[model samples]
Target: MSKPALAVLLTRHPRKPPNILQTLLEVQASLGFVPADALPEIARSLDVTEADVAGVLSYYPDLRTARTGRHLIRVCLGESCMANHGAKVLDRLRAHLKIEVGETTRDGRVTLERTYCVGTCPVGPSLVVDGDVIGRVRPDQIPALLEEYQ
Candidate 1:
């Protein structure tokens, strides 16, 4: 089962502090999200407690514990993005998709999520569509942006 495979992720971590981050990232990459059921397995593999695994999972915004859609849309709402009217962009998406930030479209084509920042604050109002960082996002552009994915 994949749970056993998850242990393989930590096999290379011999003497260092249990690098749970990389292991969890790999798990997420394979399963799309870290299944709650695998938490104990991950901890046992790394010689840490289940709480440690859960802590790392909850601490990282990029990590997700729930299944998302085929296309993951992460909108930035950091101070810089919000100052640049990022909320309007978020509102437009919510209206267009008729789904809130942690929701997937009924058809499961798209999943909308909120991110603090994508490190493009200089441009502000940035977002990520399927891992591609986009800056200077205007509300009017949301339709065309989503069209490409939908």
Candidate 2:
């Protein structure tokens, strides 16, 4: 099935103009992260200045301005996970995928990200693939886990 058009699903007009940050947040939540071109679209739709839209988007660390992959792979970098070799896990994945932590593959298969916490402390060195949590990740196991999706 085709995924829902993120922009239309996210925007909720409350009979008043959406605040600068609110509009962007809605877009981010639905679209995964805001695209660079989305700033102009948001400004035109909300009747807000382009600068205002850009400012709000830049201020939020959770928002990304780049194109992303189909599946978002978020690895916890929390203290527990970090101590358990989370960095090595991320590095191995990056090498196997041939992409940086924040980048997607050429075919747009996956995007790698380092998140602070996924609230799975007991499962340290955890990895979340498209919102499905897998705990106790070992560096060597990343390739086999990713092979399933291929």
Whole-model alpha-carbon lDDT for candidate 2? 0.80
Score every model by TM-score: 0.86, 0.80
The C-alpha local distance difference test score for the whole of candidate 1 amounts to 0.88
Residue-by-residue lDDT tens digits, candidate 1, 1-150: 365576676565554677889888988887889889988888887899999899999999879898899899999999999899999999999999999999999999999999887899999799898999998889999999898996
Candidate 1 residue spans exceeding 4 A from truth: none
Q: Write the residue-wise lDDT of candidate 2 on 1-150 in tens digits.
A: 013354454355643656877776777766667877666767867787889888888897678876578788998999999988899999998899999877889999998889998899888899999889999899999989998765
Q: Residue 72 in candidate 2 has what lDDT?
A: 81
Model 2, position 114, has a per-residue lDDT of: 90
lDDT score of residue 84 within candidate 1: 95
Q: Single out the weakest 10-residue window by summed lDDT for candidate 2.
A: 1-10
| Superposition TM-score, candidate 2 onto the true structure | 0.80
